[model samples]
Target: MDKLTVPTMAELAAKGESPEILFWVGCAGSFDERAQKITRDICKILQHVGIKFAVLGTEESCTGDPAKRAGNEFLFQMQAMSNIQVLDGYNIKKIVTGCPHCFNTLRNEYPGLGGNYEVIHHSQLIQQLIDESKLKAEGGESFKGKKITFHDPCYLGRANNVYEAPRKALEILDADLVEMKRCKSNGLCCGAGGAQMFKEPEKGKKDINIERIDEALALNPNIVASSCPFCMTMLSDGVKNYNKEQEVKVLDIAEITARANGL
Candidate 1:
């Protein structure tokens, strides 16, 4: 892949220019090896569509989703306040996040603390691009005649009611879109939400992620598409447990979009 040119908020500000949107690279997108690929794909899509965007870079901090979910309200607020200070200083008005955890917190939870902004998940932005005919699915042949099943991130689907955007993005590829029994509002959790990812699972007949993957495998999809980093980790691990990693591949929506457009 060619090197990508992404600007930091400070760099753009120094030039007396402000980006139209802030690309919020959540903790996973910044540090997790697998998720960093999604981060780059998102940047490629933004640049391909000629959208002006900037990242906070080191100025970006965790959205405190884990802390809040772990019931550490005090720590969550401290981190949130610090981020709000930096974002407000930059005069950021619109944000597109790679992680649904960040999307939920920054969009829903922050406003109560006097930090309000137009926050959207990358899936929504991708849908918008496709709708405006900017992303014409020029390389959609990559996914043509393939079977795909999308795993809805809990925060993106149930919590925020963003069900159509991601499917619309996939629909443009002309692939056979299959739906799991527990999709849409009834989507199952990948067992990584609510701070569960940081600890061992409690006693159960089966892990939640395994069960979720079982549902997807039932459809025999070529690609298990997701829009969240946490879900990506869990689903990929589940596929490994069933010894089906070779046959089934896990991918993010942004990655699929970037690849389809040859970005």
Candidate 2:
């Protein structure tokens, strides 16, 4: 991957000439090409609707969510502190993140490091945009014949109580929604959370994500939509590894939203 280039929150604040919002593109969004595209699309939607926001790219650094989940509290603290210093220098008071893990960490964990800021997941912001008439579903396209299911990321649903925004986004797409047996607050883990993204999964009866994918597939949905990049990556891999990729597609909520918006 190319080296990440991002402005300090302060620099972005100065460039915009008015303090408004900063978009925190997490490590996955920064490193993964597909995730980056979704992040850009979200930013475009927000910007087109008159929401002033700046992208904090690689400069935003890792929120150390994986480190914290991996039992490396010291490393987590160090990373959190470094991020706090950067945000403080920029005098940033609010942030929007594309990745759910980063969203959970910034919103729930940063205060412990003496960093307090209003943080929002992209889903929340997008929902706001829709409500304010800043975004609207394009009229001509619809997935009338397609059936889809949503996989709630633990960090987004259980961790942050964000269970509606992505669904609302999908609803606008006009897809036939199928509820998983284990969804929402009782949702199954993708086995990629708690820094499981950084390490190999422990040997178990079955891969947690594979099990989750199997559940989604049993419903015979055309797509598996989720809000987290990690979920997208893991679920997509599970489908491919299990030789079921042809039967289902994995997409980020932003990607689905963009499609619905005709972007």
Residue range 1-263, candidate 1, lDDT tens digits = 35688999999999999999999999999999999999999999998888999999999999999999999999999999999999999999999999999999999999999899999999999999889998867853489988999999999999999999999889989889999999999999999999998999999899999999999999999999999999999999999998998899999999999888888
What does candidate 2's lDDT look like per residue over 132-169, in tens digits? 77777774356676899999999999988899988887
| Residue pairs whose backbone atoms clash in candidate 2 | 10-90
Question: Over 4 Å off in model 1, which ranges?
Answer: none
Q: What lDDT would each prediction earn against the true structure? A: 0.95, 0.82
Per-prediction TM-score to the true structure, in the order listed: 0.98, 0.91
lDDT of candidate 1 at residue 231, scale 0 to 100: 99
Stretches of candidate 2 above 4 Å error?
1-16, 139-141
